[model samples]
Target: MLLPRSYINISFFQPPAFLLIGIPGLEAAHGWISIPFSSMYAVALTGNCLILLAITRTPSLHQPMYYFLSMLALTDVSLTLSTLPTTLAVLWFDHQSIGFNTCLVQMFFLHTFSVVESSVLLAMSFDRFLAISNPLRYAAILTNNVIIRIGIVIVTRATVSIFPVPFLLKRLNFCPNKTLLSHSFCFHPDVMRRACDDITINILYGLYVVASTASIDSLLIALSYALILRTVLGLASPRERVRALNTCVSHILAVLVFYIPAIGMSIIHRFGKHLSPIVHVLVAYVYLLVPPVLNPIIYSVKSKPIREAMLKVLRKKGQGS
Candidate 1:
């Protein structure tokens, strides 16, 4: 008589629920969403490209506010280009097995652009705060030299801060079963779990990155807005206060769209493992990928000047055609 199969054989026969189902087909849903998302990205890319061109081509937009706006547009473009191709490929092919190197590159670009975006937003907030809070010194304080220095800081800080993540991730030893990433892209935390080595250093570094970039930037943004609000209140005209608030509304909405789900994803991935992997991945992309598509539309539609400028550009192109 044949002997009973070993415990290992028995365990192999009944795998974990995740192992059985694999990463759920949520990425397939991303295909359906990709149509609208692609459209949004296309518009955003075009609009931002135009903004950059207009600012560079036009002498009048050489001021600090427009300079910051140009930087914001560039950041938005970077955000789109970083994730859109990989996302589209995953949706198109139904393939989830990303090569280790490719995954790391994607993660690096994603994090780098994300950090840069946050920094640009913070810079924009400070610019607006200064413009409104101290109108007289605004021109003096935000001179071209000062703006250029700040731009360098934004690029340098973001690049330096996120460089360690990919470097540390390269040292991880991933198990065979861990090869399949659950999402469209390689997210740091999700990939880290697959490591066969101690992740304490990685975890600590991640926490440091979050604290230094996201948390600190958010606090500074809030403080800037607070000062802005106080300054707006002092304005004698209710119309002026409303106009000031309106100018900030786009940035406020953009920040909320970008950060809330990001922080939530970080929280749930760390503490709420009981939740579905599919749900987690969905939340991750919605935060990481969605706002870049949403921002241009929101800003262009809400801000009359931008909307008018876009329309004028389009009209001119149409006439030339």
Candidate 2:
């Protein structure tokens, strides 16, 4: 008995789903691998939630810097949650099938939060520069109204920029039986590569989004820091200079944690074709997982105000319990 022609055509053009590979060569070690990943996800969730709670609860933490930090924490929580379901499912249950539309939804949120995180980091750098460069007007410059507007713009820009991606992807016809995604999550590049149709438009649009968003944000962030250093150098008191730079160390760490792995993963995907599949998958995990897991810890350890607020929050919780 042969299958119907229309059914065959439909299956060819519209694949039922895509297969996600947890870790290509380490299938046997998946159980062991899930331990660390699950732990990191838990940390990312708890830490970011605590940071948000601390910021929202403490009246003293209502400054522009803390506002931006709260935004960052929120973005981290979103980024972590976006990948957690699919990643854990693959690792814990070996459930690899993801519907085509579902894959697109996952890809949208993952990349959207990533871009929002990048933008928030840039905004935080600007906050630092203003605080160090012009302390007198810092509050005036980044008033609550201004911060709110910036937050809106950050989210709107990310959503609008990434909105076209799914539509573009929908137009392409994926290769038959070639729907194996590289990572446990759906990535734009990985999904695009599966298309049997011409993906020139998709590639160009993807590059455009990256260059306009993350690349520009990175350059501006570096410039902001450079000006901050110059301003710090001009101060007569060595102690003042030390204090100023100390304020930036945490933000610098946060930026590095977010960007280094992210850029490394992009480079690996584009240029490290000769490298093993495990290398690509591992780097991808680092890019998605490390920043969210570490950002809260970095801030809590380095920022006294946040640490105190978090402590207060914990104490309150303990008493309530």
Candidate 3:
């Protein structure tokens, strides 16, 4: 019955390796670039964790909006962590090689967290719409159970959409030796494009997945905001309308921080045709990394409770020290 800790704590390390690429023309600057990237990573990690902690410790933040925010914070953490290691490796140490299965696993988490974040933003929009348009019914409409159910559905949707991608990619033949990737981690589109065999199915399926998940999510979010605007306009009191919209400023900023760069990257990948390598790398960084760093700060500045709670935490730490 005696098992050594090492025996139980085994690691399935990289079995096969795929090379990851740093910024192409800026290879000499990888070290320089990594400094800012590492700083952002520190901010993102600390900020998201603090947000989660503030929400968890403060009983007042247990409402539906904060609950959904907790979801967004969790997603941001996962999204950054999924790719940051390989990214830092490539940028800092030129440790660009990654295993095939590990790459697939990374791709799965990256896409999964991407979809989850999108869904959480949509849910946050819905939360604001309900709070503004029908405050009386907001609680009845989105009870704690309902929010929990929504989160489960969002996670389930992301899992189903992204689960098949790696398997599909596995079936393809990568020819002419080691397949090089454009980013520091495995991107499904980037990986699939390198396969030497027929890729029609992958292309079609990729498009289908995008349309079904992201396209629909985008449309629904826009529709929710449109309804929110219409409802706000109808409120007779100027102060009331202003206050209502004020609550939404942080969410709006979060949405823009996430979607705008993501849209730019999609456009570049699908149609921009001759985008520069640095451009793509920068866009990807903006889309994936910025939100995690910005979201907690946005909420702290915009939401009074979060700011007070964070200050209280810091004061406690100072006293304890």
Candidate 4:
């Protein structure tokens, strides 16, 4: 009987369709392209860390908006920390052969952070919705107790929603080909496709989770923004209108950057396998990881107060030396 090592070697010899895209006969070159992704992640990590530091060190930014922004920064950091190292390791060492346990841990954290991010965005949307829809009650509505409760709910919802995915994936057995996952990490759907068993349950469950959590969050966020727009439009002063709209502008942009590609990839990966794997992988990174880097920069560069706070903190540190 052929050993598992021989089977792995045989599987490695037979590359998937994704490996032949660019450069003829350059299957190994696929790993090289991932370096850019690593660099992007590193930049994102630095930016998020700086934003968190700026927020925590400066007392002037103790308002609710900045507090939410701090939470946003922390979420971004969590997301980057979760995925980037494993991806970079896979790319660098050519170590695509993840053990069953390691893959499960990766999948767990990946989905957990993803769901957390969606929940965070939902919370931010609600924050903006309250601030704009009822300015008089914004303070009363988003008090310390309320914010803490919302934070707990966001964490709990994300944790609970994604717990089943890794558990379900743990029972699957891979056969025929476990070598080529196409993407950097063991994405749930990609891993499911490798299972030797009937995957009808996996597919159905994936669809259910996607529709219920991500799709629902996106819809609610859109509705909130729509109401927010209507409220902002009715304001008498242009300044008030801009101020109200501006509060959500960063979040809206963040939501768009995060959700659009995510929903697109979920559909494409599910229904449109005919598309190029490189395109699919690129889109996945953009959706899954890019926003963590982009969100802080957007808010810092666009919002004068954050930028000023960052600058002030930098200057004080410089002067204290």
Q: Which number leads on TM-score?
A: 2
**For residues 1-321, what per-residue lDDT tens digits would candidate 3 score against the true structure?**
343465335442222467789899889999999999999999998888888888888898889999999999899999989989999999999998888899999999999999899989999999999999999999999999999999999999999999989888888776434367889988888888777678899889888888888788889989998999999999999999999999999999998898888889898888865878878777888888999999999999999998998888878778999
Query: In order, what lDDT does every prediction score?
Result: 0.76, 0.93, 0.88, 0.75
For candidate 4, the 10 contiguous residues with the lowest summed lDDT are 15-24
C-alpha RMSD (angstroms) for model 2: 1.9
Residue 220 miss distance in model 3 (angstroms): 1.0
Model 2, 158-195: lDDT tens digits are: 99999999999999988766878999999999999999
Q: What ranges in model 4 sit over 4 Å off? A: 5-35, 316-321
Task: Sum up the clashes in candidate 3.
Answer: 2
Write one digit per residue (lDDT tens) for candidate 4, span 140-217: 878878888888888888788778887776576556444356566657887777666678888898888778788899
Compare the candidates by lDDT and give the number of the best one: 2
Candidate 4 backbone overlaps, count? 0
Global fold similarity of model 1 (TM-score): 0.86
Q: What is the full ranking by lDDT, best candidate first?
A: 2, 3, 1, 4
Per-candidate Cα RMSD to the true structure, in Å, reads: 5.6, 1.9, 7.2, 4.4
Steric overlap count per candidate: 0, 0, 2, 0
Pitting candidate 2 against candidate 3, the one with the higher lDDT is: 2
Model 2 worst lDDT window (10 residues): 1-10
Better candidate by lDDT, 3 or 4? 3
